[model samples]
Target: MKHLTETEIADWVTGLHTPAILRHVEDCPECRERARTLASALQLFRESAREWADNRTPPVRMIPARRPKPWAVRWAVPAVALALLVSVPVYDSYRRDRQARAETALAARQAAEEAEDAALLSQVDTGVSRAVPAPLEPLVSLVSWNSGSWNASAGQ
Candidate 1:
């Protein structure tokens, strides 16, 4: 049988022993002695640590949590109500100011759009009022066909 490794010995201390470990430890005297020595050393260390904690460490005092004063609790609701009452008129004033600014912005935008529409209509009216386009005026004098000689209704 193979002897338990240093890690296996540690695992035994931590209660991680398998059936194989049990059988080996029972059968192997050398391994059993080694396990006992390691266990004894750990127990001594644990005892010393507990002794140090008990003797050397300072005691901790837990301070109780502070409660709110009765007067503060009594006035809390009225204070909140007063705050809400004061805030209502201020909030309404802010809302009206914002609405007025938005209305002004909308009116300005509408006036600009009306001006643009009027300018476009004036340009269209100028174009429509002309008898012929300026570019086509030069071509009009070149035509020899008189209006009385030709008719669109007859092919001739």
Candidate 2:
């Protein structure tokens, strides 16, 4: 007769063996002793595990307190204030430069328009003055008999 293996004995201890293995164990003395030993060991382990699970307790934990920040780290606010104070004047100067450029452009445009008007007026005055020469003065006075300079009442 062949002897049962350790796995067959473990299966028999756990009551999971087939009918053939069970019959073999019943007839074989060596296999029967092995199955008995394995069963007793498994029973002892299960009892110990149950007792440990029932009697176990959770462990306690502790948390530490927070510390304050250093002095140099707290100086960030004043440093930012000083940066703003320095940049304000530079920004204002840039704005004033842009305004001055706009005003200069406006003045130059007005001066060019005034010069164009003066040139036009001079052309008109020159044309009108040249239209009446010195040789036509007497003919102009005779045609303008009703003029105040040649009054008929003054002759009377």
Candidate 3:
């Protein structure tokens, strides 16, 4: 007679085995070992599920949705804009001063970089000029020429 397999034994453990399969396992050592393995696995699964349940947090409910007050909105926008307008000129002046300082700092940095570049270029023995063109020179010259012409016309 063929002995019951592990699957048949697990079905027996779960009370789902056929009567013929149960009878076969009752006489088999291999089937008994399989049944014991299934029982241990089931116990481990139960312990893990219990631990998960113990550690899990229930979700939060009940958040009140906030609505803005009309008066607050009416005052807040213009007040903020007016504050911005008054402070912006001062801020812009401060920013312009900061920008001037930053430009001066950047110019110093660029001068140092150019000096290094020039030193490196000198070391390479390539007589090519790699210096970038100054963009502000033409505009300054144009303004000076217009002012001179206006002054000459004014004297006439």
lDDT of 1 at 58: 88
The CA lDDT at 39 in model 3 is 82
Model 1 regions lying over 4 Å from their true place? 1-61, 136-156
Model 3 over residues 1-156: C-alpha lDDT tens digits?
A: 676666777777777678788777677777777787888999898778767766768633334535566588679989999998999899989999999999999999999999999899896654344232355545443443453353333334
Residue 131 deviation, candidate 1, in Å? 2.4
lDDT of each: 0.82, 0.80, 0.73
Better of 1 and 2 by TM-score: 1
Error of 1 at 42 (Å): 39
lDDT per residue for candidate 2 within 9-114, as digits (tens), equals 9878766678989999999998999889888888898778767766767522323434345465478788889899999999999999999999999999999999
Model 2 accuracy (lDDT, Cα): 0.80
What RMSD, rounded to one decimal, does every model reach? 19.7, 29.3, 25.2
Clashing pairs in 3: none
